[model samples]
Target: MEGYAKLSSLISTDSEFAMYRKFGAQNTQSLLCYQAELISFGDDLQQLAASDRRSQDTDKRLHAENWYELSRVENGKDQQIKKFDKIRKDNCLIQQTAIAKLDRLAPYNLRNLRRWLTRSAFGSSFLYGLEARAWDEVYDHDLLAFPRSYAENDKDALPQLFLGPLLELFHNLIGRLYKKGTTKDTLSPEPLIRYYDSNILRVADILITIISSGLPIASITALNYINRTITRLVVVAVFTVTSSLFLTFLTSLRRTENFAVTAGFAAVQVVFVGTATGAGNGGLLRSDV
Candidate 1:
């Protein structure tokens, strides 16, 4: 009976041991399945991370491309603006040249107007002193050339010959002034009137009358035209230089903006690299591990 009891105990213990082994094997299989699932989840997460990285890279690439395209567009726009501006400026310069030429051809009565205005005002009287010495010499010579002797010389006969031409010249000038009505507005102050009290004007007028009275009308006219032409040439040169410099400045500004866009794209690239590297280095391992 004791032997049978011992055998039964041994069998029970063996059965329990076998049951424990079976349960352990089932648990091990469950753990293995859980590990496999975790591994699959990790694989999925890795795939997602890789996909996110690729997406980010694609986004960055697209952004960079967009920036590059924008830079190209800006550059093209800048060039176009410069070209259009140049054309417009050239047209304006041409118009100015045409106007200048037309002005040169138009013959306004500038000389006649100046003479009439100067004569009507006290400007002519201001110039009387300059010829006073020469007039005195002429009067003295006239007295000596009188028909009668100096003892029989009459003041009327002596002075009439001397003053007649001078009075006639004054009357002729006065008649011209009378004919010139106040038709036109004053363009500039008359130099004769402005300098009526100036001794310099008398001195200059006397010198000019002595030196230039013998000059032909044609020579005077040619000299005046030369002076006018030189002034017009100077105006045209200034306009051309100013227009060219302004255009150059505008072109440079546009080019600078275009280059700035390119630099912005480069900066974007740098940021993308830093962000991608930082993301890769950060912890992205499976939580299950």
Candidate 2:
């Protein structure tokens, strides 16, 4: 009776159990009845252990099935690519559902679920192929599930889903830089840099914004401010260096020109640089200079 009362009190008071009640009332009742039976069989220690194992196995299967249902992709044309793209677009919804399902499980069950996901082929591919926005969603969800402070104390408490996706996105960005041209055998930095600056960097900025927003203002010490300032300076320095190199390349291309053509090429370079600088500065600044 004492054991049953304690179990009842825990089920009533624990938030995790509360979620279980909300989503799986039948399972909750079955768990309670199973516990009652274990308590009644006070001398049968073997039976108690066997029953507990069975209960744990059932919970693991239930949680695994729930997650699989939410994440599984349907078969269709270009199925693999389409499935992954759909998963990325629906990442927010999947995160919500997965978290809710996770909340209903015990810590051991949670570990089992994570193990199941990590071992599954579809799960591995889905995580490794996540794009920028999808990776952001997963990162955010991981942070929420296991904050830095909590993760410091318990390393394996939460799933490490963010790392694979982040690495995959980085790898994809690098691969995009070396795309082969059909006509010319020459490698072009212009298209590569443009794509990098516009897509990958833009996504990186968004991730930074998300991280920054979560940081406490009180934690913004002088060192933190200085670091941010130094980062901005570094970015400016890189921009200046790249711009100078591009100008040098343009000038070198005009080395074979006659005097008039060289003058015209220099003038054109000046106009092009002015236009580019204006556009780079948000196109609102005057181009008079």
Per-residue CA lDDT of candidate 2, range 1-289, in tens? 2222432343343222221222234444655665565455443534433453465555433432354532343453322334345434634434444545442223332332233234422122224442412223233323222222222212221111122244345546774567542311122111111122235334544554553343223122222343334453444444434434433432333334334443443454344444545455664455545
Regions of model 1 farther than 4 Å from truth? 1-77, 100-108, 116-289
Candidate 2's C-alpha runs over 4 A off are 1-30, 42-162, 176-289
Best by TM-score, which number? 1
Clashing pairs in 1: none
* lDDT, candidate 1, 1-289, per-residue tens: 2222432342342221111011233445665665575566566645544554466455433432354532344455533234334444534334333433321110112222224324634123223454423223233322111121212111222223222343345546663455443311132222221111133334434544553232323333333344344453443344334433432332333556545643443344334444544554464444334
RMSD of each: 54.2, 28.8
